[model samples]
Each structure stands twice: as structure tokens, then as C-alpha cells.
Target: MSDVGALGDPALEDALTGLARRRTVLVASDLDGALAEFTRDPADTVPAPGAMLALRGLARLPGTSVAVVSGRDAATLAELTGVRPGDPVALVGSHGAESSVAGVTAQRLDDGQRALLDELTTTVAELIERHRGARLERKRAAVAVHTRGLSDDAEQAALEEAVGLGEGRDDVRVLRGKSVVELSVSHADKGSALLALARVVGAESVFYSGDDVTDEDAFRVLPAADGHVTVKVGDGGTAAEHRVPSVGALVVVVRRLLALRSDLAPGAR
Candidate 1:
């Protein structure tokens, strides 16, 4: 195993080792920018090298749970991550609004909620049409305006227009991420999703990593007293207790966790 100390933060390293020793632990992470590199086209994103293998390996360890919590829909996340049904790693998609867990589904939107989504979609679509480099991403329960290719002024204008549409709409929730603005009928956030997964799996501690503004929700929800590891993957303001420099560094973190768990397993050298 590589030196745990070299993983960057000593406290984070110690916390991860402690989690490895726990009887029940949850390792959850965001996909875009966390496990996968961010791309102009979200569909083009894939997991960093060895990331999926590490997650699957960690999940196979006794008493450990792994989950991918993402903003993409569950099916898309599964397809992109190559997660088949019955895989050890769980999937939470649409920023926690959807999941692959049995008997768990996103709450159905009421008629009014549906109308709000329609309005949001139409409004964002119009803005996208006006902006030369903007694009619209339609999800099962949400719609997003992507400004990755837009000029600074156009991106700001698109964001402002999108935000205006949701003004005082209690049923609608707006979320801002890296060069994107999303409106969702469901109010689920990564924090709620992570908490729910932890409760279902009876996790004594959870280690979550993310690299977007939305990831702060998960970071805030992790139990601080349990020494849960919250890692931010890139440069940004974050609530995560620890920060890794890039997706490459995140891969190392996962490998380090795997090594620590391997050492703690029975019959280890």
C-alpha cells in the first residue's frame, strides 16, 4: 500500500483508516468531476481509470457499502458506470431524487408540479435558443441549462433568466452547479440521499467525495462526530472536511481505502 500520509491530509488519512475498521461504513461519491472528468457534453463523461474497480472492490469487502450519488438520472448513471442490476454499489441519481434501490422511487409530481417543470423547461429552452453556446439538458424530474460553452455574459444572462422563472415558486427548487442551472420538481438533495442510504445500510460512518457545488449538500449531511470523510475533489468553495487536488488524487484515495481495508481483513499478511 502507498503511504497513507502521502494522501495529503493526515487527519483525513486517519479518518479513512478508522472507517475501514468500523463494522459498517458507507462510501458514497458524486460522479461528474468526482469519479469522472467534467466534459462539455455530460454524456461523454466516464469514470476515472480504476475508479469503478476500486468502488466495486471496496463494496465487496465485508460490512462496507458503496454508492454513486449523481445529478444524472439513475439509468444514465448505471449505463455510464457499467453497473448492472445486483451490483454491490448502489446508485442515487438526479441529485438524490432517484435511486436503483428496490421499493424506492422518486415521488411522483402532482399536476401543479408538472406544470412548474414544463414552465421551467420551456423557459430554459428559450434561453438556450437565444444563447449561442448554451444547451438544455432534460432529465426525468428536472431540466438544466448548461453554459459550459457560453461566453461569460451569455452564461450569466442565462442563469439570471432561469432563476427568475423559479421566483417564489415554492414547489420548484433551483440549484446552481458548475456552469449549470437546474430546476427540479422534487426537492431531494445529495445530503438527504446520503443520509437515507446510511440509514438503510446502518452505516456507522460514511466517506463521501464530490467536486461540485451541489456536493456540498452531501458534505453537510455527513456525521461530523463519526469522523466521516468528506472530500472535495477540485478547487472550489466546499463544505467537505478534506480536499483532493483532482480526480487522479481521488483515485488514490479510493485505492488507499481499499488497502486499509485489506490490511484489516481476516487472514491478511
Candidate 2:
């Protein structure tokens, strides 16, 4: 990889330039902590000031596509991102269990999966009741136990108990994230969802950015090639090729990409 960092990486610009020339390109990102700062209450999160605008602008460009892949369910992801029906940007939620993009559908639960989800919900709800500040978030295909507002000891206790719910269960997929643990009934993940999206859109290149451990699934699947720009926002080890310190820094990088692509479009001399 290039020695340049994410904020002002000339190599990143080079990658963007190549993508602009490609027949199709996909610009996608995770919602929480990547586009928006993490809020104690997930419902209150919103994208950085011009994050959505830049994404929307990129989507409108010729041969370009943009999508948001989030852990939130499709409807809630749209609501939090200010994405309305008919919006150009596509959406994938529930860590790829749900989708609003063309040619991609949400995960369908069978009777067994539904029953498993219900059990997970009940267990997580009980954990929340005992954890005081912890909360349980119900999703379309998964149930998450969030410890964002809990004290240090309480958060640890809640996470430990929540994780135990998935132990010895071959059917359950347990995903641990920052201050949260999710137990999913479906086997879907961001990597598979992202690849499916790329195929449907016929994208020759893809740029994806994310901030959480769950996002590692997407990063690991994206080849470390020139046009496949993978970025990690915030800290911790990542499979992403580049790293940005904050959501604001990531926004700047995206806007830079938008400007570069715009310059290449057919127009005045």
C-alpha cells in the first residue's frame, strides 16, 4: 500500500482518479461512527454536515453509485440518514441482513429463524433489565445489546451476559462491536451484501469506509487494489488500507473524491 495517510493522501486521489475513469464505481460506507459520531441513543445519530450531500452528489455522477451499509435496520437506517423513498443512494442494513438496493432483497426468516430471534430478544431484554443503563435494540434479523450508557463495570457485565446467550448455539452468529453485542439469526454479513451490491450495479471499482469491528467483514473481502479504496475511521486495528482520525476527516476525504470525479465529467474545457 502507499505510504500516504487518509486525510490528504495523494495515492487516494490517484485511486479516485482511476475510479472516475472506470465504467462503474461504487462508493459505500457504514453509518455509525463512520458518517456519524456515535450517540448514546442510536436513534439520534446523524451524518456529518456534508457527508450525505457528498454521497448524493457522487451517486448522481455518471457511471457512479453510492450506498450506505449500516447495522441499523433498513427503515431506521433510512430515517437516521435522511434518505427518503426514490433517493439515489442505496441502503443495506442489519449488517447486510436487510437491503433497499435494486436486485438485492432483505433476509427472509423461516419459522426456526423467527423462533431463534424471539429467544434472543427475550434473553437480551432480560440482560438489559439487570444492567441498568444498558439497552436492547431489536432489528429485523438480529437483536443487539448496547452498553453505551452503562458504567464501566456494568458495560462489561452486560456484554459478558449478552455474549453467553450465543454460546453453544450452532445456529447463532454472535458479533461483538464497540460497547455492543449482536446475536443474529441470519448468516448474512456486510461482505456478502457488499459483493452482491457490486455485482448488481456492475461496479468495476469500489470505495468503502467503516469504523466498527463488524465492518472488518467488508474490509477483508475488498481486495487491496488501486481502485478498491478501503478506509477505517477512528482507531483500532483494521483490514482497511487507510485510516482517518474522525468522521470530519472522512467527510473531507469523500468530498475530495467527489471533486476529482466531477472534474473528469464531460463539460467545459
Candidate 3:
């Protein structure tokens, strides 16, 4: 089978093959589109088929680190992934604001941004409550307006309203996510977060996977230029080093590693 999805490109394959040989792999995957299906709320979200095994597989890899980075908070990722003993993986939640290793105390939002919560909630309530199926999500350091309602008109209007909220803050990115509009106060994105972790681990290479416009930012920056592989889940104009048809394929890649590690584990006897 010709690898036709993300990581199918020869350049990306060569990079991953090379990475497997020398670097301490850092597989930072986005939670939603990249792993789990983009859902309207946390209560309804489900982890992708191989997500748990993938984390376990990375944990077993020598000097390899895997993180489930998402817009969800730290507690949420840990709970959803069904984390067990000896898991070296990190959960970069709330868009890198709530990291299990960094601790919540380290998470910060600008004073001005923090103080705007009241206004944001009121406005968010006003904007989404009026539309059928519209949902509101208040993340740790960011706010989201989920329009999975799939109404193009509603989505367009919601984007404008989201941008309006940051009218004075040009530094803020009014990123359009898959079916949601997000407002984040922290400058750290999935990419920066990945790079920071890789640098801390003295990484020689990086393999980053994501499935949204936000993931695109991280795709632009990879550790040690040549040894990095980028995988984009689903279709988009992402500059990722590779592109996978869907999260399922992403899970397939993850499963491969998991199976590899499982075979190496001590026998059941």
C-alpha cells in the first residue's frame, strides 16, 4: 500500500525514519480534529480508537515524549485519556495554559484579559444563546464559541463577534477552529509548546500532528529544521510535513507504534 495520508510524503517519511534512529521523539498531537472528533462539549467527546494505546506506545519508547495537547483543560485530558501508571506523556490542555507537568499555578492570563471574563461571558451568552444548537465553552485561559450547528451564516457572524471581543487586543489571535471561534490570552500555541518541550528534552527531531488552522502555526516551526515531520489530519491548506485523511488514520499510525512497543513488552506467561 502506498502511504497516501499524512506522513505519506517521501520527505516526511525520510524525516520520521531518520528521527526514529537518533532523536528523542516528541509526538505532540492536537486533541480534537487530530485525535478525537471535534465535539460541541467535553461531556460528549470521545477519545480516538488508538489514542490511549498511542500514548502508552510513546511512553514505552526510550527518551520519547508524547503529549495530548488541546483547548481542554489539564484535568480534562488526563481524565479522557484514561491515564495509568508510569505514563511519561504530558497533557497540554487549555491551549498550552494547563500542563500537567507545568502545574496550574504556572498558567497565566493577562490581567486585562482575566478581568474581561464577566463581559465575555455575558456577550458569549448573548451571541450563542440566540442561535439553535450553538454552544459556549469557557476554557481555562481562552473562550470558545462552538457553532457546530454548521450554519455558514451563523459561523460567519460568530467569527465577527469573536473578533469584535478582541477589538482592542490586536496581539490576540482570532483563530477560526473547526466549527468554533476561540479567544486565547496566552501567546503559547501548540507549535511553541511543542518546541519548548523538545528543547527542554534536548530533542534532535520532532514529529507534530494536528488537524486545524491552529495546528498550522505549529507546523511552521519545528525543532532542528531537517529532522522534523509534520502531519495534518483531514483536509486543509495546512503546511504540515504530511497530511492524513482523518483522525482514524492518525490512530492507525499511533497503533503501529503501540503494537511495536507491546511486542517488546515482557510476555504474559
Instruction: Specify the highest-lDDT model's number.
Output: 2
lDDT of 2 by residue, 1-269 (tens): 43334456776677767766677889999989999999998878989999999999999988888999988889999999989989999999998888888688778999999998998898888878888888889998999988897789889989999889997789999999999999989888998999999999988888999999989999998976645888888888889877888888889889988887787743411
Tell me how far the alpha carbon of residue 198 in candidate 2 is from the true structure, in angstroms, after superposition.
0.5
The digit string of per-residue lDDT tens for model 3 on 24-85 reads 66677888877888765655788887677777667667767777878777776777777544
Stretches of candidate 2 off by over 4 Å are 1-6, 265-269
Query: For each candidate, C-alpha RMSD in Å?
Result: 2.9, 1.9, 3.9
Clashes of 1: 0
The best-first sequence of candidates by TM-score reads: 2, 1, 3
Error of 3 at 225 (Å): 4.0
Residue pairs with backbone atoms closer than 3 Å in model 1 (clashes): none
Top model number, TM-score: 2
All candidates' lDDT scores?
0.84, 0.86, 0.69
Superposition error at 204 for model 1 (Å): 0.7
